[model samples]
Target: MNEDQENDMIQRWVRDTPEEDLKPEDYQHIKTLGSACLTEGNSAQLLTFIQDEKNQGIVKSMGFVLIEPLVNEVVKKEKSLEHCQAAITHLTRVSKLFINHIMRHFFVSSLSSGMTFLLQLDDRKAACVGLVLSALQKQLTRLPVPYTKQLEEADEYGLCRCCTALADFTKSFVQEIKSKNGNYVGTTEDEELRTELLKFCMRSLRELLLDAELSRDRKSSLWLFATEIMVTLPAIQQSLSELLFFNSLKKSIQMDDCQSKESRACLAYLLFVQLITIESFPAVFSPVFVLQCNMEYINQLLSRYAESHLLKGLALYAKSLESVEDNSLPVSLLELQSFYNVPQNLRHILTDCPMQHLRASGLQVFQLFINKLDSEAKHKFFRCMLKTRNHAGVEGYIIKNIKNQVEFSMKPGNASKWFLGVEFLSLLGLVLHLSQGAETDLLNSMDRIMESLNLLRYLLIRDKELRSRTGVWEELCRIKDDYLKMLRVCISLSRAYYSAELKALKDNQKIKAKDQQTDCVLCRYVSQVLHSALVTFDLMESLIVRIEELTEEKLKIPN
Candidate 1:
């Protein structure tokens, strides 16, 4: 048969469900071998049959996706529900091939996404979703094992298609949960199914939290999956807390420090904070053994991945506020402090960390986290700033980047675009609030504002067309009042008996920025190190206001 004919057959196979009377066990027996076979590295047929379905096999493709995988791994002794329970654990344990096969099976390109199909199976429908989702999460976050079977994710178009499919699956799973909260004690079959599912969820997530020896490929993937699972755990609450101490102990062995340990740990902690679950915290953060982390490897990922990566991790840990259960997820702001900032090992990567693809990806991860936190959480985050006043792990960057914006006037060219964006929005917003004196930290410096002012002037000088753009002028003008408020802060802070702690940083000798001569010791000290654009504060603020006025109609720059 031609490729088209073969795809048609596979699609029909998926759409054609076996008789409804067939036991889930019988279904398992028939499909398990095919599933296992499909998982064995590259299956050109899996991709070909699924990808080229000529609008004919859409439903069949989904059916075949489930049956093919079940056929591969199901054993003769494994009964259906038991096999289903096994299915979850089996997929989690299988080599990455399983993940790839499952993912390709669910492949719905952006083009085909809006194309609807008759999806009628009840139990199997959810089972397929849970299985594939569980598998994909593992594959994406974890590093692929040595010589693991691989496929062409190299092509940009294919990656985009995969991303689209993944997004759809994630959305569907979320919607399924939102559909309703069915009664748990309603019936025997319902109870049995829930029990099996709970086990599956628990086992996979446990691996994520407590598994000590995750292969490098699985490590990162598991970290992300673990977080996504948190959103599902409220319903699976009992399973979440059910694991015995012994089981928890066994899993702890796998968490031994490899390179991404800190980031993994951070992800684990973030899940707890966001989900408010304490069920597995002790297991995941088991201080069971005193494993020393490889500080050098960590520093490298932090510096190279992003200053923001390090910052976000530290902030999430420090702001661990109260979880829903008593002391569930209990690493205090102080306990987790050691992981923040560039440790000696990672300093080399931080030296001019490029804001290229890698760092940008890290930023995306950072946003995924911060966006989940509500306003109260955000307020709590800042409150941690008070706790870390003396601790630089979290505050050093904020002080260096935002509060020290004036120093950036020197090389404004090298300043990070991310830093500049935050400088105008969050940090500066904080400064403006603090300057109001309605509730301000008098110790805050005004020199930061002056530096941003300088940076703005620099931008205006270089980009006349930008200056001419109403949006640019609007931004500068709007923030003009903010600058005045900051000026008040500088005066207030300088006038107050200084922190005395920062006196050294405030001294003239410490400054290295060339424009330092005319500025105050605080301004010079900060500007010396800052690489902000040398735009004037008022002009910078005005630029934004102009931007707002010109495009104030809320146009989306037609990207």
Candidate 2:
């Protein structure tokens, strides 16, 4: 047939076919015509046909069919860079148009097959990899926003499917690398391909993470996918080690004049933090991986960017790992020591460069670490807290900070004292945890508890002053009385609870079975700790009552 006649027939087929009615044969026919049109410099008509909303399904299907062959043709011996670029450009456009509907099958087939062909041509691999990443990023940019019910559903399904495809492509690529291993020693071209592939994967995953528009759920799903692939595939480890981790470290160490080195270091740390914090694969990620990655080297990088978000990220990452239930994961004592030092580092950060969010991050990490401590470690950990408390300088920083915040809020015409009161109460609870054993350990624990109670007393006095200034002294006094009553009730309940726990421990210890002694030791220790905690709570409540009464007496005796 003549070219015009053939073009007319293709147009009729596109215009006439109902999307649901089009069979696989019809899809092939459409794909063939589309490829022919591109070859004849008729891409405008092809694009126009594909852009129609009604033809999107068919067009998407045809895209799946056309992508592989076009990529294969570009990587052929007869093809040049221009042909490859043109093919990728066309694929990139198609990807954007139908990205939301692109399935895992399409991604896996095209990427795995296309990468296989492209790996053969060393000179063109970088250009081809760039185009591949560009196209993938464009598709990723079209992921459904996880807002509405329908969109969220679509987002979950699409993200999971895309992740599966990427995982499959990674598996195939890694397999190829393994098969070609040792056949050509120190081949720069092979290294280049490996580097490009790793960059593509890391960049693509990082793009998903850094896209503020993407919902947390979507980002988390992508994170899980990346983590799974990285952990399960051994072949990619070399590239990850060389290109993603060590290369960035090397650049950072050199401290080149260019900002790219710092940028790369930041990206490397970000990716590392993401990998370690994948909640689903806690067991899969061995503690040895952290050691293997050279924690000291990572610490050096962190030190260089001490004031940057890197420290905050590390703090948060440590916090995330604190909740893992499994103890078999290779968290060495050295790693724990490193984590223990976070509060000290944070103290420095707070002293030298105090960013509020970073301080909050540091405090969060400290709190999580304390919560994760075993019975054996509690004493040591508490000693560390005591040292931190002392190193933090003046007393009442928490109370002073809260008072300043309250005063600042009042200036903005926010007279709500209830939230402020509740916040102070919560801070008091954290202080209680910090000084749990203070009654028994007078030198370390009791002093900290006294400091906290003094802080709380100051807060109550400050609150009374603020209420007087706001002309709601009586109302605020009533609220304070009510909160005091609640504290009394809490102390009473804690006393009863601890008493019962102590009795239970005593009863359990009386058991004669040899095996029961070990259990008794644990129970006795827990009961003793509970008794001390209860005493501290009791003392704290009494102090609050006395301070409230004294403040009330002082208020009534106003000049």
Candidate 3:
């Protein structure tokens, strides 16, 4: 959209929000719909209508712009929660399987977008986070094409919402753990919740990282997305450690010494870091991994490739070793350790490193993954981020870095984050498409991604008049052609989300729109769940940002 149109939409949306979120009509509508969905075998009817294309598109888009603001409002206020609590209570009364069935129907599109929208608004961040997460069941399968495609269209907004919501949802949990500040063996009840949550988080992370619909630069969203889940990890250590089987997975992928040795090593470390960041660690592992595959074999293969940029980034972020000035830290390094210590195993990469690699252009984010990566490199080749140390700024640094990589702005500019995010998504989609269900042969995908990045990188470097580091810029004549190339890749990958057909209906719109009592429960409930995650995360950020504002101080860590 042009400037005027985008601005107008924003203004209208902002102005339209109600002062008090309680809407008598919304609850009445929810109750009526709840009655229908709960009636025997009606869920199949609810499911059938949404899969209809016209029904899916209009419903998914129309809800937030119309119905969802009411949902968002109710979620933000304590008094208004009765609307949601009543809905969830009624559904629970019906059957959890019924709720799960309804959610799975719209689980991807409507729910993900709802979560994103609420996250943007800071008022109800925490509760929304919890609520949003509660929407999905374990073992979610590939949804209908129309629904999944809706998500690719909604990804940026969806991801942002999910992250913000998760961040907010986990705030209390984080604080409680921090306050306790001891070796933690959580309560069995708490441990069960933590395990369920981590399983959900890791699976989501895996999917986000693997999703081809994302662009290369926007791929960093995967990490930020991972971080939202990771930052919440320390609070649920026992559960995470217990659920992830990374060690066993690591034991299986061997790096035969051919030319692929370097790539194999990188894959191993990526998987290792993936394991470590589980928010739970060594606790979940077993000697079963040792029996399955030798560490000696792993070390033998990886040691040869460890010197590549792949492993360099891992060591810097996870271990945090100090480096001699003689060899400056690689910009692609996402996690690191200080120079002083013996190599240690912390299983805490996401909290520590934002610069983990994906796609071929890993070095693009070398500078923004952490406050430290923000440090200047060679007088403007890469400038350090000039922001404060409080949580909001910290989070912004993450967002800024993520955006610089690539995401769904639709508009292209010099932001490496946005460009690369699309690239990452596209390349991931390439592999998923190419894999056609096989384990990724990274060597081939890596080659295609590297070629794409090189072309784009050359465009960025050659554009003399480009904005050096701002988030927005005109998709001007200079880099226009290359960006189009990038855009096309994402467009193709987005097809995986497409379906052979959206079920046809006889006067379907009339049936759906007329029978207001029989609303799309999947869309309504899923949206509610999403908003909860988004609002809570944003609230925590607002709280942290507000604290920074009140104290007029930044939380500085001396180098």
Ranked by TM-score, top first: 2, 1, 3
Q: Native-vs-model 2 lDDT?
A: 0.50
Decide which is better by lDDT, 1 or 2: 2
lDDT of 3 at 287: 33
Please give, for residues 66-128, the per-residue lDDT of candidate 3 as tens digits: 223323433445554555444333333323233223333333344545655544544444455
lDDT of 2 by residue, 266-342 (tens): 34444445443334332444444543333333343335433433452454346345544322233244346555544
- TM-score for each model: 0.28, 0.44, 0.27
Best by lDDT: 2
* Candidate 3 segments exceeding 4 Å error: 1-157, 177-186, 212-219, 239-559
lDDT of 1: 0.37
How does each model score on lDDT? 0.37, 0.50, 0.35
RMSD of model 2 against the true structure: 19.1
